[model samples]
Target: MAKPASIPGLNPEILAWARRRAGHDVATVAKRLRKSPEDVRAWEAGDASPTYVQLEKLAYEIYKRPLALFFFPEPPEEEDPEHRFRTLPAFELARLAPDTRLKIRDACAKQIALHELTGGRNPAERLVFRDLASTPDSDPAGVAEKLRDYLGVSVEEQRSWRSAAAALARWRESIEEHGVFVFKSSFKQQEISGFCLYGEEFPIIYLNNSVAKTRQIFTLFHELAHLLLRLDGITKRDDSYIGHLRGEEREVEVFCNAFAGAFLVPQGVVRELAGRGAPADDEIKTFATQLKVSREVILRRLLDRGVVSRQHYEQKAAEWTDDYFERRRKSGGGNYYNTQGVYLGKRFLALGFQQLYRGVISRAELADVLGVKATSLDGLEQRMLAGTG
Candidate 1:
């Protein structure tokens, strides 16, 4: 009989650290590794170790860390991502899905790559909108007008768009043109709408693609509010947490929400359609169609201006919310390459490929930066060049 394989010794602290940093519990790690929770606990407790083959999988696949890190005398200190970006409380942030955590880390790495590729130059130097700053106390309507001019997304231009999806694409492209990297992901959790990472060189805004296109449009502006405020943070549209906030926290949330509404459904346009009376369902739908915003957005704006009663607004908002999610559930995901283009913003991929083509980075390096296999680069390049992805 062959002798039993020897397990490699690893620092137990590093084992524990990697799991925690990945936001995984023992059970989760065990399930991914096809082991029992007790086995994972034993590894972390220094009572047992994974074999050489198992260690490689744990480091590369499970923990997504370097194998050398496991030999450290102590787990190296990792910067709390929550500190760099204003997010929920630490406990709440830790509860974020592992996939979300991984995506955040991947985005951070990609931002670093962009910064290096640009020779540490500030890409926002030429972006007029990056300098457009505002405070929570600023007038939402005024700020919205400035942003519209900066983005060149006038109501007239928006009216010419073929559909809401087209408007969304145009808006995203406009923002990316201004030097912000806008990407989308199908987050499993419904609570998280989007997040922004503030940077002088490559600020990033990530939108949840699983939601309705209209909601994603709203979130796009909401994150833009964060970028304008220079407030890097994660955003969730869940109404349950509203009552829990107070003072500045509450003010920031309210300001961003109001800014998104004003930006999408300009007050002037709202007044033009709404006049002095409560708007009917048909009127709300008409405004929503013309503005390319959700009916809930129009209703909320009317509610704020006393054009709609609170009771009526609440009923309409709830109904619209339910219908939106139901429709999203029934809709089929479209083309894969197109979805990939949305996932990895066109501008981002363009920059990565430019670097690759210029020999500034190797194909392997580009794959690492873009988070794809090196073999997949050729296909991705073909799709991107054809404007299919």
Candidate 2:
């Protein structure tokens, strides 16, 4: 066999930096690259270097970084994304899955690119809730009211949507109308519900599509609370960690949770429902159905208002949680284009398509941004356009 040619002047530190940045250990990288662990260690330790083809595979395929980075004299000083956002602690944020981190980084890059493409122009009209005067000590119900008004989506309007999916679409559109871009992706991890990337020009919210639509609705508002507060970071709303958080971190979570619940199921509506007497499981379901929220949300509200006992609330919550996951598992898969539409979001796709049409970005670049193949661009564009109609 012919020997592969080597690339001179490759920095071993850069190779190590890329691997660490992708959250991959030497063993994992070796497995992915079909190389021995010793070989991977040798390459990183400057004892041996990869050939050009191996370097390309390592850069683009394995680490998902630019090939040019390998030539840098030293590892670039990359900012900790969590530090730029006050929503979560650095340690907690670092615990996210590698794919989740990459998705976030990609989303942030797209946002920055969009901002630059548009010449840094701000949205013509500002979101009313963008300047909300609520604090951690502020009334959650009042804050919810303000957000509802800003969104201009009434409970009657929401109920009239007739289905959870429809209601989610309506709410997402309304929020996007106010200049925020919402995207969905399957985190493939249960702990992370959703996250937001706060930006002055174009803020972004990401929902985990693997969850139930009702749960996604709650996540939408939860992330809205983050954007409204101008905080950015990933959110893992797993109950196990809630009790461990303290101070501002805990307060932020509590406030966002309360605001999301209150925004979806208004306090007055909960009070009125409870006035009829303690709600049964069916009644809770009915309330959730009417409000277009998850039963878990309504049950929490009931527990807070003394309408349901702690034991009853916990039992119902556990049952609903289990049922939700089972349904998710049994629902099987959906159409690829449809799922991609939901994942990329109409607003973000529209922006990308517009850029393509204006010759600001090439079709190849558009495909890259949309995370689809160049050949798939035509159909994706058609689906996106048809969706807008």
C-alpha RMSD of each candidate structure in angstroms: 2.7, 2.6
RMSD of 2: 2.6
lDDT of 1 at 298: 86
Number of the predicted model whose TM-score against the real structure is largest: 2
Compose the digit string of candidate 2's lDDT tens values, residues 215-302: 8899998888877777774566454465667887777778888888899998788888889888777888888898788998898887
lDDT value for model 2: 0.79
Model 2 CA lDDT for position 11: 92
Taking all chains together, each candidate's TM-score versus the true structure is: 0.89, 0.90
Q: In model 2, which residue pairs have backbone atoms overlapping below 3 Å?
A: none
Q: After TM-score superposition, what is the CA distance of residue 190 in candidate 1 from its true location, in Å? A: 2.3
- Tell me the RMSD of model 1 versus the true structure: 2.7
Measured with C-alpha atoms, the lDDT of residue 58 in candidate 2 is 91
Alpha-carbon local distance difference test for all models: 0.79, 0.79
